[model samples]
Target chain A: AQSVTQLDSQVPVFEEAPVELRCNYSSSVSVYLFWYVQYPNQGLQLLLKYLSGSTLVKGINGFEAEFNKSQTSFHLRKPSVHISDTAEYFCAVSEEDYKLSFGAGTTVTVRA
Target chain B: DAGVTQSPTHLIKTRGQHVTLRCSPISGHKSVSWYQQVLGQGPQFIFQYYEKEERGRGNFPDRFSARQFPNYSSELNVNALLLGDSALYLCASSLNRGNYGYTFGSGTRLTVV
Candidate 1:
C-alpha cells in the first residue's frame, strides 16, 4: 500500500508570486504520483503526473512538479500564480494495482 | 467526449436512511471507482469495479456496496447511513488498471441529516 503526505494544509500567496506545495509519500515499490486541482464544488482536474522517465513533469497551466525518488516526494511548484490558480491541491500515489491514495489536500489562496 | 457523469448532484437524507449514487463513465472507459470526501479532507477510496467485477475495496464498512453494469456504469449504495456519511461522493473512470489519471466526476454531495 502507498500513501501520500501533503505538509501544508493552507497556502496564501500574492498574485504573480511563486509558490510551492510540498508532498511526500511512503512506498516501498515503484509508484505513480499525481497532482490534482479542485475548485469549490467541482471535480478534480489533473495538474500533472509522474509515472516515469522525467523527474520534472509539467502539466496544464504553469504548474509543474518534481518527483524525487530518494526522498519519495512529488512537490508541486509554479513560477507565477494567478487568482485563478487558487484552488485545493491534492497529491496522490498509486502502486501497481492502480489504486490511488490521496493526501489530505492543501488549499491555495491567491490574492491580487 | 463526455467526462464522468454522476447523478443527483445533491441529496439529503436522514440518519438510517439508505441512499444510492449513480455514475456513468466516459465512453470507451471500462473501469469505475468510488470515493468519499469529507469536508476539509482528501478523497478516500471506497470501491473499484472493472468489467462488472469487484477489484478493490477500502476501509469502508459493510453497509457500503457498489456494482458495475455491463455498460461500465456503476452505482454505490449505502445502507443505514450515519451523519458521518455526509460527504461528497466522487466517481472516477479509466480505460484500464494502469495509471491514466482517471477522469473524475463533479461528485454527488450527500448530506445526511
Candidate 2:
C-alpha cells in the first residue's frame, strides 16, 4: 500500500509570488504520484502526474512537480502564482492496485 | 465529450436513513471508483469497479456498498447513515486500471441531519 503526506495544510502567497507545496510518500514497492487541484464546489482537476521517465513533470496552469526518489517526495511548485491559483491541492499515490491513497489537502490562498 | 457525471449534486437525509448516489462514467471508460471527502479532508477511496465486477475496496464498512451497470454507470449506497457520513461523495472513471489518471466528477454533497 502507498500513502501520501502533504506537509502544509494552508499556504498563503501573494499574487505573482512563487509558491511550493511539499508532499512525501511511503511505499514498499514502486508507486505513481499525482497532484490534483479542486476549486470551490467543483471536482478535482488533474494538475500533473509522475508515472515514469523524467523527475521533473510540468502540468497545466503553469504548475510543476518534481519526483525525488531518495527523499520519497513529489513537491509541487509554481514560479508565479495568480489569483486564480487559489484552491485546495491534494497529493495522491497509488501502488500496483487501482486504488489511490490521498493526503490531507493543502489550501492555497493567493492574495493580490 | 462529457466527463464523469454524478447525479443529484446535493442531497439531505436524516440519520438512520439510507442514501444512494449515482455516477456515469466517461465514454469508453470501463472502470468507476467511489470516494468520500469529509470537510477539511482529502478524498478517501471507497470502492472500484471494472467491467461490472468489484476490483478494489478501501477501508470502509459493509454499510457502504456500490455496484456498476452494463453501461458503466455506478451507484453507491450507504445504509444507516450517521452524522459522520455527511460528506462529498466523488465518482471517478478510468479507461482501465487508472494507470494514467482518473477523470473525476463534481461530487455529490450528502448532508445527514
Candidate 3:
C-alpha cells in the first residue's frame, strides 16, 4: 500500500514571496507522483506529475516540484505567488494500478 | 473539450437511505474513478471502471457499488448510507489505466442526516 503525508496543514505568505509545500510518501514499489491544486468550491486540477526522467518537474501557473526518491519527498514550489494562488494543494501517488493515494492537503494563503 | 462532469452538485439524504451519483467522462476517455473526500481530508479512492468493467476497488464497504455505461459514463450507488458517508464525492476520468494523471469533476456534496 502507498500513502502520502503533507507536512503542513496551512501556509501563509505575502504576495510575490516564494513558497514551498512539503510532501512525503511511503511505498514499496515505484510510484508516479502528482501535485494538484483546488480552488474554492472547485475540482482538483493537475499541477504536474513525476512519471520518469527528471526529478524536477515544472507545471502550469509557474509552479514546480522536485521528487526526491531517497528522502521519499516531493515538494511543490513557486518562485513568487499571487493573491489568486490562495487555495488548497494536494500530493498524490499511484503505483501499478490506477488507484491513487493522496495527502491530507496543504492550504496556501497568499496575502497582499 | 468539456472536462469530467458530475451531476447533482448537492444532495441531502437520511441514514439508511440510498443515493446515486452520476458522472460523465471526457470524450474518448475510457477510465472513470470515484473518490470520497470528507471535510478537511484528502480524497480517497473508492472505485475504478474501464470499458464498463471493474478495474480496481479501494477500501470501501460492500454497500458502496458503482457501474459504468456503454458511453463511458458512470454511476456510484451507495446503499444504507451512514452519517460518515456524508462527504464530497468526486469523479475522475483518465485516458487509460497506465498510471496517467486524471481529470476530476467538481464533485457532489452528499449530506446524510
Whichever of 1 and 2 has more DockQ, that candidate is: 2
DockQ for every model comes to 0.83, 0.88, 0.84
Model 3 chain B worst lDDT window (10 residues): B94-103
How many steric overlaps are in each model, in order?
0, 0, 0
lDDT of 1 at B59: 98
CA lDDT of A19 in candidate 2? 99
TM-score of the second chain of model 2 compared to its true counterpart: 0.99
Looking at model 2 chain A, report the run of 10 residues with the lowest lDDT sum.
Answer: A93-102
lDDT of 3 by residue, A21-101 (tens): 999999999999999999988889999999999999999999999999999999999999999999999999999986889
Error of 2 at A91 (Å): 0.5
lDDT of 1 by residue, A1-112 (tens): 7888999999999999999999999998999999999999998888899989989999999889999999999999999999999899999999988888999999999999
Model 3 quality (TM-score) = 0.98
TM-score (all chains, Cα) for each model: 0.99, 0.99, 0.98
- Supply the DockQ value of model 3: 0.84
Fraction of native contacts (fnat) of each candidate: 0.78, 0.80, 0.87
By DockQ, is 1 or 3 better?
3
Q: What ranking of all candidate models by lDDT puts the best one first? A: 2, 3, 1
Mind giving the per-residue lDDT tens digits that candidate 2 earns over B3-97? 99999999999999999999999999999999999999999999999999999999999999999999999999999999999999999999998
Model 1 lDDT at residue A107: 95
Which of the predicted structures, 1 or 3, would earn the higher lDDT when compared with the native?
A: 3
